[model samples]
Target: MDEHGLVSREFTHRYVLPEDTLPRSVSSTLSPDGVLTITAPKKPSPSAPNERIVPIAVQGGPTPLPVQHEP
Candidate 1:
């Protein structure tokens, strides 16, 4: 809705990502000329990490395995 109470334009789009994306990495930009660009970097593969940190759980509790480095 515009200030003059009129519908100037509307847009809708559906996109499918080829791979999982990194957390909080999705972004979109609209140029002055009305060009829209979307960017999302793919998530690192399971084998991408060269090093990982193995957390020590307390009394058999759950532990989170986190990657420390990427190769």
Candidate 2:
């Protein structure tokens, strides 16, 4: 409050979401009690490949990383 018993304020906000999230599904709402809500639905996942092979190149020494596959 400066003078005349008045008040002023300003603010900014940002939100980050996953790349797979459906942009058109995003929604937001603000309640009367000063509460804010945001929601978005994810895009359907693509079908997985039955099998895949990845080639690894060896350097001067044995790779310190282990390879694993997930279902």
Candidate 3:
């Protein structure tokens, strides 16, 4: 880089994304004209819980596990 006269160069480009939401898939394309295009699908909605009943065996007897339900 020093030989190419590009040593110690500082970049001023910054991009920040959401911390909570995330894209499942991402697509990008770079044209011959030095143009970059990025595309992402819409965020998906939360799905219903697949309620599963799990039983645990304790020393005394069998205890039914509790299920967590999000309001």
Scored by CA lDDT, what does every candidate get? 0.79, 0.82, 0.66
What's the best-to-worst order under lDDT?
Answer: 2, 1, 3
Best by lDDT: 2
lDDT, residue 33, candidate 1: 88
Off by over 4 Å in 1: 1-7, 48-71
lDDT of 1: 0.79
The residue-by-residue lDDT of candidate 1 on 1-71, one tens digit each, is 87889866777888777758864788989898889899889887676457777897668666679969978
Candidate 3 local lDDT, 26-71, one digit each (tens): 6769797767776665566666699566897659767779999999
**Which pairs clash inside model 2?**
none
TM-scores, all candidates, are 0.46, 0.46, 0.33
In model 3, what are the clashing residue pairs, if there are any? none
Q: Which consecutive 10 residues in model 2 have the weakest lDDT in total?
A: 45-54
